[model samples]
Target: MAASTSQHALVSAKSLCAGPSFETRTSKVGFVSVRRCCLGARKLGLVCASNSQSSVMEPAQLPLSPQSGSTPKKSSESALILIRHGESLWNEKNLFTGCVDVPLTPKGVDEAIEAGKRICNIPVDVIYTSSLIRAQMTAMLAMMQHRRKKVPIVVHSESEQSHRWSKIYSEETKKQSIPVITAWQLNERMYGELQGLNKQETADRFGKEQVHEWRRSYDIPPPNGESLEMCAERAVAYFKDQIVPQLVAGKHVMIAAHGNSLRSIIMHLDKLTSQEVISLELSTGIPMLYIFKEGKFIRRGSPAGPSEAGVYAYTRSLAQYRQKLDNMFQ
Candidate 1:
């Protein structure tokens, strides 16, 4: 089962969005109609009402076993994969990208492909990406390398017509496809006036200390840009309102988003303090894994290549899934 042998498919948004009657709200970002399902849930105490208090907890690592089985039980835990988008043209040029749309550089493309290889054997039932070209590209490229061979289809909810027209006729086709939902809430922090400014030059012009405060401080925003706190407000809210339900539904989710937005989500999941999160750094195109079980998130760190025995040793379900992939493709 070479990855190239798997063909991609596009299904209608209506087919994917069919579920319990939840309120669907649509917002306009430029020309794209971002349809957000306002599926609400009670506060899990995962996040505190105040950001000042630290909620960091060292949850015990879930015990791992080598036992491999063909099918996972309904009670089996789900996997959550978080990946920062690959480097973009502005990143290579050392410019402030913020929310400005940019394509991935050639090295970024290679990085995305390599990232895909690292997690190729992992199960990915659904994907969520920021409505930006670089993040979207990274996700599409990564899925192309998945061993499962399910095509990642971007669900377009721009309009009622678009949703109605994109529906898949066959039920079997829906099973072979993964729905990719794009939301502006997952987009990078808006940099305001610094969108295209060179980072080094801005630092020099604004004074190093001031520039450092604007970029690193959790609460302080740039001249007209969003602070990390501002980014977290939307990112974490979207995670709770929209993404969490899918995970609760036993869907293995992969989020392809930008640095600041993802950092905010990580902050919530890990219960990191504002100070602790400020120091966190994420490299482009690297995938981090976490297990969501019993209403708690257990960090599994970054998964290595598919051949790495230790990577699959984290859970029986993962090991079994990997073994199944090996058997199918061998």
Candidate 2:
């Protein structure tokens, strides 16, 4: 009687735990019934869903190409690193900075220095930054820690006189320098009327949902502000037009810019959905690496250490570049 009572209790517990019933379909291959659970279903090559009534189950068609199974090819010898500028004075003040140029705070300076240390070993042939001082400061500070010890010089291309004055006549000195190009196209999303306001206060004044919509919605802009989509228009265009050619010619590049601007670029790089891009958040000063090869950008994520093994293992070209740098130091 005790054993029977225990068995009944077990069954009752399972019934309670199950919560809901789901219809399952049987497969022809092994007569295995599709599971009601979604966890690990993708790995097992099974896609099943039940109708609202829980009476009918259907198997979703899987892609026939099996492209997911194969490793992507690394056809080009180029790497791209994106770093959002370290915490600005406005960031410390909790102000919506937008296109307002602000300098890095003391902690922000340290963050940039730490960022430089993390990417010290990585090859950076060219540096791109926004017209903002914070971005330019981050770029310069980060380069200061690079193992290459190459000088980061601002490219003065605005006027012929400025270009001539900024020219380095010494070919050797020029070879030892990385061109830092500043573009207005890479600037932060224009925050419009919200630029100088405190974030929490603004949210309290305009409703949290409304403020969130203005800041995060892909297409909707704050009153007179640039939406993320609008920011992507110029940023991604500049990337394709100015940066792609350099990468195609086998150049490793670093871009230091604002959060929203970098998000726009990352959206393009990762081919993220509009919904996916909306949730993407980038930490200040931390550098994210991408292997740009075969016209595809494969994200390697942030390097855990300055070791080549962590990040350079993705591409033979990057490994070779690291070797060249090692030889130079020796």
Candidate 3:
């Protein structure tokens, strides 16, 4: 998203919301915590949190520790199950994937299948995926393996839940078309000017320093794409608006998105700095979970480590992208 003062306000206004997006004005409304509201990264246990208030000039607060998953909720606070998409065509080709729409590769399909195997048993309350098909397809396949047909749509009616949960603390069944919800807000980092360029070509033509700046700068956009800060602003806004409510209501959520988009959320939820964020790189099809408890932030999964690179060389083995991956393995 292009930078706007309103985007800044969303973070600093300390607003409250029922949807993932919140409206702001001069009113000093209750604040929501982003970090404390996420699910935990513990082996299999869930993390949950209650709502918290926010004053102006603060990033939203996160939830504290609680145990929960994807069952219909009778209480507040929820959990999260976050996964990146499988290997994309551009990914397999070793290309820069700023905003170019692409699909999962054969390897990508395998990764998504593995992801399904990873969380086949977890009760996913609601599914939030990016508008991109790669993310969406990966999510759909992953869920289809474990979750029942169609994604679960969240019905945020305190009144409705009050009546439905009278007998049991479970989410009442609603007649939603699909359980999955798509929001452009959750799309991958928009690589403005960098789309369709070969990473090696860009590195050679523009030099490594310039490419690094374009890729990692917090405030600088690529030739036509968004800066990390800008992406963070938009992604954060969406998370606050459409998703945080479910987390607060104690929904066990699953977010299947891209590298940079997830990075923005992780940056805020984990209190990562510009330096740390620049160093961070996400792997395909891996699940990175975050836990919240009692309306406060508790750290869960970090960005995945670099494994099998020197040994298995998942990126380098491919013939078309081999040289490029060889040059950039570190």
Could you say which candidate leads in lDDT? Answer: 1
- Report the Cα lDDT for residue 181, model 1: 79
lDDT scores in order: 0.70, 0.68, 0.57
Per-prediction TM-score to the true structure, in the order listed: 0.78, 0.75, 0.62
Question: Where does the lowest 10-residue lDDT sum fall in candidate 3?
Answer: 53-62
Task: List, residue by residue over 1-330, the lDDT tens digit for candidate 2.
Answer: 323332332233233223222111111011111111111111111122221211111111111111223322336556788899999999999999999999999999988998898778678888889999999999999999988898888877676677667656676787777878788989999999999999999999999999999999999999999999999999887776667655655668899998889888877765556886776667788877666655555554454345423222234555566678789887
Off by over 4 Å in 1: 1-74, 307-313
Which 10 consecutive residues of model 1 have the lowest summed lDDT?
2-11
Q: 109-192 in candidate 3: lDDT tens per residue?
A: 988877776555344666778878899878877776663333433222235453344322223333222346566777877887
Cα deviation of 265 in candidate 1 (Å)?
A: 0.3
Candidate 1 C-alpha error for residue 172, in Å: 1.2
Report how far residue 3 has shifted in candidate 2, in Å.
Answer: 44
Candidate 1 local distance difference test against the native = 0.70
**After superposing candidate 2, which stretches have Cα over 4 Å from the reference?**
1-75, 307-314
Q: What is the lDDT of candidate 3?
A: 0.57
